[model samples]
Target: MIYKTDMKRWLDLVLSIIGLLLFLPIILIIMILIKLDSQGPVYFKQRRIGKNKKEFYILKFRTMRIDTPHDIPTNLLLNPDKYITRVGRFLRKSSLDEFPQIINILKGEMSIVGPRPALWNQYDLLEERDKYGANEVTPGLTGWAQINGRDELPIDVKAKLDGEYVKNISFAFDFKVFFFTIAKVLTSNGVKEGRSHSKSL
Candidate 1:
């Protein structure tokens, strides 16, 4: 509980600072590529539900066309690929698009490891997370549910995995999720282009 109540925020601040410093060059490169591949801004900001169900804007490298629908889950969007820029596809696949969220972590709006934030419009997912107290902790750049299934898991199942993380929160567990997330990103595992069904979003 000490990890969750006290040390986690400090850890997030230190790690996010280190990560941003380390990835500065790559971040610049990604920004350039995004500009070349799309006509919009270099970053995309979306409102997301964070700790204690508060809302915050989560930042990521812009990966979609400027005209794409706002506040909609990609899986629920019609012809999602049609709206994704070329570099966006690679960013999504490689999970590099998430690098900008180090800013969020640094800002204390998120953590390095916790439940992934739900989109503001993802009412069902938010309600489900509330059931298990998953919304009590700060959301993360990558999380237990993210490593377990990423975009492929159903809403309830994903929330359950997140709850499991809340139950077992610790440094060891966080490291495990972080390490496996790297492997998942490398293999592009548990990533799906879109879902066939909606979850009441």
Candidate 2:
């Protein structure tokens, strides 16, 4: 039998391409806005761990000033607001910052649904996820942890949710996640409300 995991790979490719094309105009607009709103790259890339503990650069829209400290998790930052650009704040709030990860999906570094990638330096989250076997599958644009509580969830809780997602992988489950993501994005709901944890990729 063709496993759903294989099916999910093809699904990621198809949907990511389609989504890229559909959002191209909006992406361009956002790029221009970011450029005008800040003095830095429109896109940001950071090293993140993918399946099997492989490291890959995750792409995102740059939502922070050029001098923002890199490698530290947002929630650990002492003063996140000092680095967030005006446009970056909006992108983070709308979850539009995540759109650039379509490139990661196309590169097979990620899926549309799975555990969200942890930064390469995020050993705490990385270790927790590894313990739960969440790092065995491709990371995602959004996942069970994202839908459940996002940044509000503790590291261990996030890993548990990710593990649960892996166990429940299916076309139906993915569809369910897709719809919930749309709803969250539209309502700007479930996202952490503080800029303290909204720095960059």
Alpha-carbon local distance difference test for all models: 0.86, 0.83
Model 2: per-residue Cα lDDT over 1-201, one tens digit each: 244647889888999889999999999999999999978789998889999999999999998888977777666767777777888888888889999999999999999988888888888888888777899988888888887877777788888998898888888898899889888777776555335453222
Q: Which candidate is the best by lDDT?
A: 1
Clash total of candidate 1: 0
- Model 1 score (lDDT): 0.86
- Cα lDDT for residue 16, candidate 1: 83
Residue 79 error for model 1, in Å?
0.8
Model 1, residue 75: distance off in Å is: 0.7
Stretches off by above 4 angstroms in model 1 are 196-201
Which window of ten consecutive residues has the lowest lDDT sum in model 2? 192-201
lDDT per residue (tens digit) for residues 28-139 in model 1: 9999999988798999999999999899999988888999989988877767778888999888888898899888988899899999999988899998998899999889
State the displacement of the C-alpha of residue 62, model 1, in Å, after optimal TM-score superposition.
0.4
Name the runs in model 2 displaced over 4 angstroms: 1-3, 193-201
lDDT of 2: 0.83
TM-score of each: 0.94, 0.92
